[model samples]
Target: MREEELSPGEPAPRAREPVFLLPGSVSALAIILVLIQFASTMVLNPDGQNMLLYWFAFQPLRIVASLTDPSLALPLLWTPFTHAFLHGGWEHVLINVAWLVIFATPVARRYGTVGMLSLFLVSAAAGAAFFAATTLLEGVYLVGASGGIAGLTGAAIRFIFQPVLVAHHPETGERLVLGRRLASLREVFANPSSRYFTIVWLVLNAAVPLMPAVIGAQLGVAWQAHLGGFIAGFLLVPLFERRLA
Candidate 1:
């Protein structure tokens, strides 16, 4: 007769445990990329690695040459997307995987599997294009998933900071929310965490190019790609978002 009382045949509800799980689509893609990088480094010799980079890495010089000569056009066509899967080293791939997991989880949860894949492909291509446009050198190569990860981060900012609707569970006393809504740009900036995140992201991107000189090491950070990907993700999230019912 009591509201919280269980019926004779009913079982009591279990408390929810916080468990961190790798998102399905993001994990699969990240693993594949890591495997490819590992294979390129361990299975292949130095010459083979060079050949792999030549074929898959995005090179602005190749595109420029393709303009003058039609033969180079075909390879350049797919390099934008392919280059994202290739990495310069273990550190590069690992760093990307970390970011991919953090940012892509939110995106995969909000957007369907197809939407996540679409974001990655589009962001990667946009990042490559921007890098090619800004990079002045001829022989430089761009590789890694930083651009795609940056895009995921940008897409996440669109909705992650919004106030969630929550209520105490009838019996469990646990907080629960039905769904989330996108926060307005004003609201996002008004929140200290979101505001700081946006500001820090912008400053980091701006500072990336200078990092090589600052640290006195050749850290080939494609900051242009990061900016392009972030812009693309932030602007394009609306296109991918499900219409509220």
Candidate 2:
């Protein structure tokens, strides 16, 4: 567990593994969400569980109302946990899983196992809060992990943008070492193809909601969820590191 730093002057400690299977907690959550949605099909058909009613639609007043009186606000507050696990359809799940798997796993690895778990829970909560407070004000209901995923994005950006700090591992007393931190954000998308991939990601997020509104079709992107979660993740990343060994 010794994490001795090898860098002459580099700040952040690098992760040990090339692939962070567990870091991308989103993958598991994504699968779970799909499964939950699938299970719901057995009891409540997709059409029955309308996104407006069944999903964790973030509505601040409603959340407060629920806290004040659960009987009345049950619909609004209760879905926060279950909502992330539900989706509109296969295409919807696939898209979310794609972004989550591609971007989130690496982020998780940097944070480590416990850090990854924090990303899932905290980001999810953040997305729920943001949606409930903002979109709910507009009487719109939102469900999904986009907000939480956004936290992952923010966390990744922080890793890219901020100063790296290293410390000793607590249990094994591993010193901070090289190959721990993903070196640079710029390095990730240095490839022309990766640049396009990043662009596509940004564009898709912006476009998801727009398509449904403008085209009169259902696009159930839940972009608010992504934004909220990302913001939460951005904050939690440092906090999590502090707790790490």
Candidate 3:
């Protein structure tokens, strides 16, 4: 469960909040995604857009085929990272970006710019790897930032629910929130809120593949990629985070 603590003291001078609270790295990444989508939709011709997707979007069949045909090796080198910048539509991109901001903000605040980007890139690649493994020989293309955002969501779960430590200044009696302690794996499961959130997230992804039958419409959701990214983020965040004393 999440807990907030405030030290007992007089209020300190208030600082003005900036108009744009998002970190520079997050803004840069979002702008790149938006620009790519804009170019795909408005700047590029039909053939050009198709070529862009063909070369950049992750294709399971391509990886499997590349095992024997070395000519396909070129795309295998980059598609895992590139696929994240491509999206099926504006709606898909917008939704992914919105989620990215929510989950990534905390990660960026805790892990800094490099760590944040590292988690995103590594998770995106993990997602591609999982998708390729599960969908071998299937002619399908995967694109978008869902995998990376899922990773951030999982990583955020590691510490977001922890209690914040607040200490008051002995001299001026200024309220200070010292820091947040990262939850251990055991503690995460032991905590009811985090445990239930994890369960719900897993259930939602598992149900994605069955959406077509339930709603009588095909909604392409790469649940495998999401799962892979989530696992990677949840397990690998400690590598990016600083140890608390």
Candidate 4:
């Protein structure tokens, strides 16, 4: 067939959208987490690592003590969010980072960098609050990004399973074919996949305290933090979507 010529006013076809998934902000956050883990494991001596935890990790006892002693209050303000950046070991951080990619990507794509960061920080802080409420008077330090990751996971569930949408840019006519509609609460619970997933997540986290006995090892999984973060993400994602709307 002979080549066809475009009309005088017709625009050329838009370029293919890139397939890259990791947004710059998400990659930056992931890199920061890995670097912190590397520093904890390789660069920091035992004493230095301990000091890092003391200053950054979330501890229920410290929060309680801060109520009476203002001198011990400085760390309390930051530890809630900072502890999500700290980890107990390589395995802990690695697992959290993996989940962060899986869960945070969808959220970052929908909400943009600012919304993703807001959800993460708020969830981390909420996790610390839950941990403190459960472990008050029990000297336990909470670390790792699982709580924040769980929040991302919960936020993702709001739209992850919806049908993908295909549209074109108004100006460029680009073949933009991604993203799903945010599901309503009724829709989420009505759908078997999401409902079952939520139930399973809740059950697993509820059983976190008993994990040591079941596995015969001390895993120190903070279930309360996970639940708190999940709840926050699940409830707050609509607000993010609304803001965008």
Q: Give the TM-score of candidate 1.
A: 0.85
Report the lDDT of model 1 for residue 41: 86
Minimum summed lDDT over a 10-residue window in model 2 is located at: 177-186
- The lDDT of model 1 is 0.85
As a TM-score, model 3 comes out at 0.88
lDDT (CA) per prediction: 0.85, 0.62, 0.89, 0.88
TM-score head-to-head 1 vs 3, winner: 3
Give all TM-scores, in the order shown.
0.85, 0.60, 0.88, 0.84
lDDT tens per residue, model 1, 1-245: 65787889898899897575877898898889889988998899999999998899888887678778989878788999999999989998999998999899989988978888889888988898889888745679999888888888888988887777667788999987756676667877898888899889979897987887779886578998898888788779888877554
Candidate 3 achieves a global lDDT of: 0.89
Question: For model 4, which pairs clash?
Answer: none
Q: Could you give candidate 4's per-residue lDDT for residues 169-194 as a string of tens digits?
A: 88999988756878989988988899
What is candidate 2's lDDT per residue for 1-245, written digit by digit as tens? 86675677787755687663544455566677677667656667657666435445444556555666887576654566555655556776677777777667767666665776677667877788756654554655555556656767767755443335667777988877433343234744564544454567557765766786688998655666666676576556766653333
Candidates in descending TM-score order: 3, 1, 4, 2
Candidate 2 — which residues are off by over 4 angstroms? 1-27, 46-61, 64-70, 74-78, 137-139, 160-177, 180-220, 242-245
Error of 3 at 202 (Å): 0.6
Q: Residue 209 in model 1: shift from native, Å?
A: 2.2
Ranking by lDDT: 3, 4, 1, 2
- Predicted candidate 3 versus true structure: per-residue lDDT over 116-165, tens digit per residue: 99999899999999898888788889899988888899999999988898
> Candidate 4 regions off by >4 Å?
1-20, 165-178, 212-217, 242-245
